[model samples]
Target: MTLIYAMPGNELFAELLMQHTGYGRAGLSVHSFPDGETRVTVDTPLKGEQAVLVCSLDRPDPKLWPLAVAASTLRELGARRVILVAAYLAYMRQDARFHPGEAISAKLLGEWLDNHFDALVTVDPHLHRYHSLNQIYSRDARLVHAAGALAAWIASHVERPLLVGPDDESRQWVEAIANLLCAPSVIARKERHGDREVTIHLPELGRWLDHTPVLLDDIIASGQTMLQTLRSVCAYTTPKPVCAAVHGVFAEGALDALRGEGVGDIATTNSIATETAHIDISMQVAEALTAVCNIITERRWG
Candidate 1:
């Protein structure tokens, strides 16, 4: 068993973690410094105990500071082992060299955290074609695919839903979710030149588009891709609802931007705690962690 802790930056995340852990003891405290920095303290005794720090890596700049401090302090407090549960992991998109001299930020972030934690757990991490978080982080890093949960939620709410992937990259998720719900799926072609601009193309689906549709994606950093897909689909078909695994990273004015585009309702798995986030994928996250923890325990103690 491990001691679970959460930060003020993500109190709801902490509560969810506690519920999932089924561990009666949960502890956390965070304070802001005069210099605008933050400090966190774990009041419970962590000596020689396994500790699970649950934090959603939303806006990295603000959350990173406290996360670093908390990890270091917990390590110093004699925690025998530390596991990080990041509901949303940032800086994972830069897995490849898009241009010359571009730093592989995802690699750096993974390596940095690799030195601190025993295991990493994240839900629906944005992975590129060439790399994965497990390859980036040396320790056991579990990428929890929430497609099943998302599919189940959609099935419970909507009947005969069509899953639409915003782009080719999201087709994997779209297909997985559709399979889970026993539904059909399609992926749009997306073209992007730079930030804040995108083009999505969807081939005609005719009567299939007339039914309830649920747009799905692994990440929604800027919401541009989704808006483009929504517009493209809406242009030729009837209005359909949209939902995603990770919602509303809502970068910039993405929320308003998407709403302005006539997006009916949006839901996400609490990967980044947005207003559109109506669901929590903590249970899914916990299940992934449990699997990883089991493997590690077997390998270490076998």
Candidate 2:
């Protein structure tokens, strides 16, 4: 039997997984001390069952220790195996040291996960520098693309959407979503000066002026890239632009900031929980988990 256990913030997502997988309910208790230390307790017997641990590593600092302890505790409690299903994998942005004495966080965190969990399953991770998760994670690390879920949401709502990509890096998935929706797409040029400072050079959108402009990016952390792109597109089209992203890590007041700049609609996958997270990626993740479970059952760990 597969049993699903959720870390503190991941309970709702785990419940969805349980519904799809028809997996039995299991629990994990988290207690934080006055000294900023964490205590993790597995609440049920996990002997000989595939223990699926749900912990979306968004704000990962506070949750890391609990996750580590929980995984270890599950193993100690006689779980046959431990699999991590993170809706959003964190610490993937920094793959190298750009300056002196900078830590390669992606590499380090990947190694840490390998040491703690037997397998990993997560939605789209930032892979600009690294080609694949295999480059970093040696275990059964799987990628569940959020494009299908994003496309599904778009198809249901907007009748006409001119898909807009923030950069060349976003081309692959944005194009996939566009194809699924059978919509015309364009790529914008982005020049990033700093974290919040970005300029987007949009192509002449006069031809597609009638269609609703949908700006799609893998992440919208600061929301600056989409903000600039929306403003540029607004110059040509009268229709209010729609912002679509996989992970809505709206840093600070990025959501309100985007709304302030006249974004008509904002939709993001539930990779990171937000009021803007209207698009649900749990079905996609559940499907991926079924495949992962099959592999684990077959003892395929490469």
Candidate 3:
């Protein structure tokens, strides 16, 4: 098997994956024309070998065409199978149409990738309405959890940690981490008025006043939820709440906004490359990839 990656700030992740899986590395060179056209080149032969493409679809629009070209080119280069390891799968929020004539981008992107890759692996995709990745994707799809790593980080770093979920949607993540650490957990009631405006009703934390509150969530896109929760927690307590997430999609100065709002600390998994990626989830992802490769190998030999 060979790993091929194309993106800035992904070299470290690629190196970690290579070290963990002992997979050969393949080079991919991308050139962009003045007219905004792109040319993708795979610099290594992949004939009779499984090709794994490592890409995190954070800002996915500009990378889509090149990814498509690369995946198709891998098949033409005689790759036995092409597997996609998308650390942070995008367009998952639009799993369903909220309004009439709305396009379901999640399903569309899933179908598009399904047509290209023989298998897919991603970490903590935004699966709101969709129960599983298999519901949207046709290929062999796997979703790896980052909660264990996050929980371990919290247990080691934070003193007397009190896991707090911003809203009901975050209950699963909070409970998982809290249970792992054997700590108390609380969930805030959230009412979304708009994309930027949200009302968070936090549960009473007086019982665990000595414990440091750590707000946990799956994805932090707009930061509205975190901001609201931070303000509410601050109003009632002295210790500033630390905010952490699996995928830190800090969109449009959201990180700045969180910092400005006096959030104690902000950190996230290395799903998308950002300054706040203090916790490493590369081992988790590499383990999943190894498992997937083992399964594929067993099936091929069986």
Model 1 poorest 10 in a row by lDDT: 239-248
Model 2, range 200-228, lDDT digits (tens) per residue?
A: 88888888979999999998887888888
lDDT score at residue 137, model 3, on the 0-100 scale = 94
What tens-digit string does per-residue lDDT give for candidate 1 at 1-302?
A: 56777766676776776687675446778888899867687765557667778888878877777777877888898877778988888888878788899999888888888877899998877787546677888888888777777777787777778788878889888888778777888888889967989888787678685677788888777888888887877777665666565645778888787778777678887877778777767888877777766776677679
Residue 244 lDDT in model 2? 93
- For residue 141, give model 2's deviation from the true position in Å: 1.4
> Between prediction 1 and prediction 3, which has the larger lDDT?
3
lDDT leader: 2
RMSD (Å) per prediction: 2.1, 1.8, 1.3
Candidate 1's C-alpha lDDT?
0.77
CA shift of 166, model 2, Å: 1.4
Greater lDDT among 1 and 2 belongs to 2
Error of 2 at 35 (Å): 1.8
Cα lDDT tens digits, model 3, 1-302, are 65556454467788788888898888887899999999999865656778888888998998788888888988898887888888999999898889999999999998899889988889999888998899899878778899898987887778988888988889889998888889999999999998899999988888988778898999999999998898888877667789999999898989999999888888899998899998898887888888887788778889
Instruction: Give the distance in Å from residue 238's predicted Cα in candidate 2 to where it truly belongs.
Output: 0.4
